[model samples]
Target: MKKACKIYDEKTIGKFVDNELSSEKSKTISEHIETCPICDSITAKYNHLSNIFVQSTSKQLDKIDTDLLGQNVLEQIKREENNFFKKVFDYFSPKLYLKIASIVAIMIISLTYFQERLIRPLDIIGPSAIVNSVDGNVSSVMIFETKKSKHTIIWFSEA
Candidate 1:
């Protein structure tokens, strides 16, 4: 035997208004409402209320895009993360300091290892002397440049 028709609640009628009921249930409700004046009236009220609810919230509903909004938020987070990482990299970069220190160390090492070659030319001499005799005495004179001052000095001696 077929089961008796079930009375759907107002909420279910709201679902029917939204076309959410199964095909069989929707046909059954439609047939039942024709013979039930109370259900027919309730269904009408539910449809009216559902339409009003949709119309009232339609503007806000149209403005909402959860996917686009979530993507925008993720993009903002990525931008902020990139900025933070850039700041951190700038703070910790060692190339400049390392290059400067390396150059300075190389220069110091070269200077130390080639001190003599750097200070004075290999062609430079230490000193020179000239001697001459006048009357019965001999006189000698010597001249040279000091390493520190680069000035010539004359020494005179008589014997």
Candidate 2:
């Protein structure tokens, strides 16, 4: 047990030992610790505690098997990578392709039926050409329009 310090607390001394304080504060603490016996004893206690902690941590690290840890981590990574690629390959299987093809075929058939049954052809509208009346001597007259060129025709026959 160290005596209670008035000038600097134990936390300040601990920071000084850990080098956690700023340069100016650390210098001030160092000067105070040199002059004050109480601060000096507290700083020494902190330093001893830090040393003991470092020694115990070093022993713990030495006892651990780093090679086994590294090998286990690498094996886990490889297994995850293989599983990811397997899922991607499964998505593009032959059964999936067949299902996609069937869906596309159904869509094409539906669109074809809708167009033929529901929608009317452009040529079904009234003809652009107009004939007011036909005069005498015309036994038969026919009016029509061509498919591709859309040209109107007026055919007359006399008996």
TM-score per model over all chains: 0.33, 0.45
- Residues 90-148, candidate 2, lDDT per residue (tens digit)? 66667978799789989888877887654445534655577787776889999888775
Candidate 1 Cα errors over 4 Å, as ranges = 1-22, 61-75, 83-159
In the range 66-109, model 1's lDDT, one tens digit per residue, is 77888899998788668977767656568987687789999999
Clashing residue pairs in candidate 2, if any? none
| CA lDDT of each prediction against the hidden true structure | 0.73, 0.81
For this target, which candidate reaches the highest lDDT against the unseen true structure? 2
Q: Which one wins on TM-score?
A: 2
Give candidate 1's TM-score.
0.33
- Residue 112 of model 2 has an lDDT of 76
Residue 69 miss distance in model 2 (angstroms): 2.9
